[model samples]
Structures are given as structure tokens and as C-alpha cells.
Target: MQNTVTIGKQAEQYAYQLLLQQGLQIIEQNWYCRQGEIDLIAQTNDTLIFIEVRYRTRSDYGNGAESVHYHKRRKIISCARYYIHTHPAVEKCMIRFDVFSMSRDSAGEFSSHWIQDAFQT
Candidate 1:
């Protein structure tokens, strides 16, 4: 069985490919700050997006996106703020929070759901 970190890396890689295919310019991956980490950072047009990638092998508790609760959202937001502070060039761009939810079924097929503007600051 794959460990959680391995599964997460796979999921994030899948999400990265999907975003690239959709024409979003990926700026960074696994960006970290004192508050927390942002899974992926991308830009589409004038929008600067902060993405949170969640992966789950089962839905017994909930799907991946559902796992990003209020506290998690707050942490992501805080981290995004720190990111913007450090990267002044993107400060004038419109900011958006996104979620890339991935799940694997019994057959080992992976599925992804991309939620644009998944949360707010």
C-alpha cells in the first residue's frame, strides 16, 4: 500500500497536469509560509490562485474537498496572505482560493474535481 505522502504527491501531480491542460500557468508547488502551506499556485488571466489539494482513498468519512474545513481554510488563507506579502508583483492581481479534490476507487482509478474559488479570505 502506498503511504499518505506518496498518495498526496501523486494527487498533487495529477492536479498539476490537469491545471496545465486547462491553460493555467503554474507558478509554484507546495509553497510554505509560517502559517501553513499552499499546495499549488497558478494564474489564469489576471487571477492569482492559491490551491489546496486533498486526496482520499475512500469516502467513508467524506470526500477530499469536504475535509478542508473552516480551520483549514483559515490556515490556507493566512498562508496566502504571507505569500502575497513576499511576492509583491502579484499583489495587484485578483486572488482566488481553489480546491483540487482527488479520490481513488477500488479499481485504483483516480478521479479529480477542481473547485474554483473554493473559499474566501
Candidate 2:
């Protein structure tokens, strides 16, 4: 079995490629702060995006995107605030929270979903 970190990295990578395909330029990956961690930070035009990447091998409970509940949203929001506070360059940019998810089907193939403006601050 793959360790949690390994699985997470793979998920993040899958999300990263999807973002790149959509023309978003990645600013940082796995950005950390005391509040929490932001999986991927990217930019598009004049907007700055904070992304949360979630993956699940099975959809028994819920879809990966559904996993980010209220508390998780709050943590991401707080971390995004901290990121803006520490990075003056992004202070003037429009901020958006996005979620990218991947799930494996019975055939063992993964399908991805991207939710833009997934939540608000």
C-alpha cells in the first residue's frame, strides 16, 4: 500500500498537470504556514488561486471534492490569508479558492474534477 504522503503527492501532481493544461502558472506547491497548508498556488491573468487537491481510491464515502468540508474550507481560507499577508506581490491580486479531485473507478482508472471558486472567504 502507498503511504499517505506518497498518495498525496501523486494526487497533487495530477492536479498540477490539470492546472497547467488550463493555462495557470504555478507559483508554489505545498505552501505551508502556521494556519495550515495550501496544496497548490497558481496565477491566471490578474488572479491568484489557492487550490486544494484531494484524491480517493474509492468513492464509497464521497467524492474527493466533497471531502473538503466547512472546517477544511476555513483552514484553507486562513492559510490563504496568511499567504497573502506574507507575500506582498500577491496582495493586490484577486484571490480564488479552487478544488481539484481525482477518484478511481472499479476499473482502476482515475477521473478528475475541477471546481473553480469552490468556496469563499
Candidate 3:
């Protein structure tokens, strides 16, 4: 069985491909700072997106996106602020928070849902 970290990495990779297919340019992955980690950073023509990737194998409680509660959103927002403070190049762009959620079906296939502007700073 794969560990949680391994599963998360796979989910992020899958989310990465999905974003690429949608023509979003990937700026960074697993970006880390003292605030926290942002799973993926991508750019659109006029927007800089900070993405949070979540994965779940069971829907016992809720789906992946639903798990990004208030505290998590706060952390992601704080981290995004730190990111902007450090990366001046993207400072002028519109900032958006996104969630790339993944889940495994009983057949073991993964399905993804991308929620743009999932939250805000």
C-alpha cells in the first residue's frame, strides 16, 4: 500500500496534468514557506493561482475539497501572502485560491474536481 505522502504526490501530479491540459502554466509545486505549503502555483494570462491539492480514498465523512476547512484556508491564505511578498514578479497579477480535489472510486480509478477561486486571502 502506498503511504499518505506518496498518495498525495500522485494526486498533485494528476492535478498538474489537468492544469496543463487547461493551458495554465505551472509556476511551482510543493512551494514551502514558514506559513505553510502551497501545493501548486500556476499562472493564467492575468492571474496567479495558489492551489491546494487534496485526496481521499473514502467518502466516509466528506470529499477532499470539503476537508479544506477554515483553518486550512487561513493557512493557505497566509502562505500565499508570504509567497507574494517574496515573488515580486507576480505581485501585479490577480491572485486566486484554488482547490484541486481527487478521490478514488471503488474500481480504483481516480477522479478529479478543480474548484477555481475556492477561497480568498
Candidate 4:
């Protein structure tokens, strides 16, 4: 696998562990629809969470979380809607959008940040 893909996978695994530690139950990953892909779908305290995962090796451009552009938010929101349509019970549940970003050092150690409700629908 490409280095970036491998790093991303590791970051996702780390993010998943972080979420679980926070008492979130994961429902799905890499959820795809005509609109786009939702990196994660999870539940906590009667709330459904849609997550976006981003990893950056360096901040030369900017932090990974800042990389989520407007178009991407629209796509994620649409995908969340599609997911809700597929699961009507969840449609009525409180929804939150989160972003998890991982910044990696040369040693491959990563510092991850969780930003809840980072964007709105």
C-alpha cells in the first residue's frame, strides 16, 4: 500500500479506539452513497455521529482538520441524510458531525485530535 494510505489506516484505527474509549458504539465505516462517503457512523447517548477522518504528515499546508472544505461538508451531510433514510429509527435521533485529525511525527507517532460538531448540516 502507499505510505499515505497506510498512515491513514493507522490513523483510522487510532481514531476508532479513541471513539470507543469515549463510549461511542460504532455502527459503520466508510459508508458510501451517491453523494459521498462517511468515514464513520457511531452512536453515543442516544445520538448518532457522523465522523470524518483526516491525517497529515506535516503542517506544511495546514492542519488536516482544516482540509475539510465546504463541498466536502455538503457531501458528508448528504451522505448522512442518505444513511438516515436507510435507517429510519436513526432519522429521529440527535445527530452530530465530528472530525478526527492525526498529525504524525517523523517517528510515526501521531497526535490525534477529536473535534465534535465541527460542522453543521
Cα error, residue 70 of model 2, in Å, equals 0.8
- Across residues 1-121, which tens digit of lDDT does each residue of candidate 4 receive? 3588887888888998889999999999888888889888999878999999999877888787899989989889999999999898887799999999888776767788899999998
Q: Write the per-residue lDDT of candidate 2 for residues 1-121, one digit (tens) a residue.
A: 7787887788789889879989999999999999999999999999999999999877788988899999999999999999999999899999999999887677766678999999999
lDDT of 3 by residue, 16-40 (tens): 9999999999999999999899999
TM-score, each model? 0.97, 0.93, 0.96, 0.94
lDDT tens digits by residue: candidate 1, 1-121: 8999998999999999999999999999999878989999999999999999999887898988999999999999999889999999999999999999999877887899999988888
Rank all candidate structures by their lDDT, best first, as comma-separated numbers.
Answer: 1, 3, 2, 4
Where is model 3 more than 4 Å wrong at Cα?
none
lDDT of 1 at 41: 96
Give candidate 1's whole-model lDDT: 0.93
> Model 3 TM-score?
0.96
User: Clashes in each model (backbone N, CA, C under 3 Å)?
Assistant: 0, 0, 0, 0
Off by over 4 Å in 1: none
Query: What is the Cα-based TM-score of model 2?
Result: 0.93
